[model samples]
Target: MNLTVDIGNTRTKIAVFNGEQFVCEEKFEEAAPQHLLDMVALYSPDKLAYCSVGSGQPAFETALQKLSCPVLHVTGETPAPVTVHYRTPHTLGADRLAAVVGAITLQPETDLLVIDAGTCITYDLVDAAGNYLGGNISPGVEMRLEALHTRTARLPRTEADGETPDLGYDTETAIRAGVVRGIGYELQGCIRHWQKRYPTLRIFLTGGNRYAFSNAVRQNILTDSHLVARGLNHLLEMLP
Candidate 1:
């Protein structure tokens, strides 16, 4: 068994995998030593793969060490199952790389556009030849809403829910429509452009806000909430 942990900006995800099959997963607002200890007790995984975008927490690291498992901290320089073409590989996000690897593992040799809508909206592409071409990043839905509230005095920080209209009828609705619908259109446009370039391109959507915009995205898209975990598991398999 293998354990994969992804510590994101707002949440931490832990997944247990038996070979290539995902057994179970858990999410926490933040990772703590107790959380790691509990998972270790439950799964007793032989190998662990971890990736984080935030500063390392010593307590959590200590807990992982106590697990007595071979822990692989995924970095840009870490050996990946895919070829990285980014000019500044060191600056590439570990989550993004893991997501690409997961996509390839799921679909194998096919052109892929992996969209992760989490703290940020990231679009990473992997060619059929397994070369990872860097993607773009934009402010996420929550960030957009927060930015609107913070940047201006009158605009309120509104939560995105319900149906988004093409145009806003009032102030609150207008903000919701602008942020949610605007992102929907942006994602659709990106998918369309990629499809034109790679006619057989496969689109995969994941991350926190995937459900928020999945219905609005106008493409033959596949959604997997556990992409990063799966990718981390795949990377773990690559180890000797």
Candidate 2:
């Protein structure tokens, strides 16, 4: 068994995978070293791997310091199954790395567009030849709402459902429509642009808001929430 930790900007997802099978999965506001150690002790995984985008947390390293098995800390330099041509590789987000690795593993030998709809919507591309082309990033569903509230005085904070109506009757609904519909168009535009360049590109959607926008368009998007975990497992498989 193996443990995969994805420490994001706001939360950390920990999962126990026996090969490709996940026995337990959880999301935490933050991961403490002791909490990670306790999980390892309880699950007794043979090895552990973690990716972090957060600032220096001594607790995480402290817990790994005690581990007897291989403890791989995912970094920009980590060996990937595909070739990355990122000019500023260090600036690449860990979440994006995980998502790209996930996409390549899930559908090898195919052109891919990995779209993650979370606090920030990211669009990453991997060519059919296993070369990772750079991608674009933009504010996500919630970030758009928050940005609107902060940018203007009269616009109240809008609450979002997974679905936003096109013809909004209220202020909140209008915000929702503008944000959600705008995002949908933004995503579709990217797809169209990429399709013109690479017609066979397959679109894969991941992250928390994937379902909310799944039915908004028909772009052949595959919703797999466990993409990062799958990538983590694939990374473990390639370890020497």
Tens-place lDDT per residue, model 1, 191-235, is: 999999999999999999998889888467899999999999999
The true-versus-predicted C-alpha distance at residue 150 of model 1, in Å, is: 0.6
Worst 10 residues of 1 by lDDT: 58-67
Evaluate model 1: give its TM-score: 0.97
Clashes of each: 0, 0
Model 2: lowest-lDDT 10 consecutive positions: 159-168
Q: Estimate each model's TM-score.
A: 0.97, 0.93
lDDT on C-alpha atoms for all candidate structures: 0.91, 0.83
Give the per-residue lDDT digits (tens) of candidate 2, residues 1-240: 998888877778888888867677888887677678778888988888788878877777777767898888777667888788889888887678778888887798999999988878999999999888889999998899999999998999888774477787888888999999999888888889999999888999998888777876477778888788778766876788
- Candidate 2 stretches with Cα past 4 Å from truth are none
Error of 2 at 141 (Å): 1.5
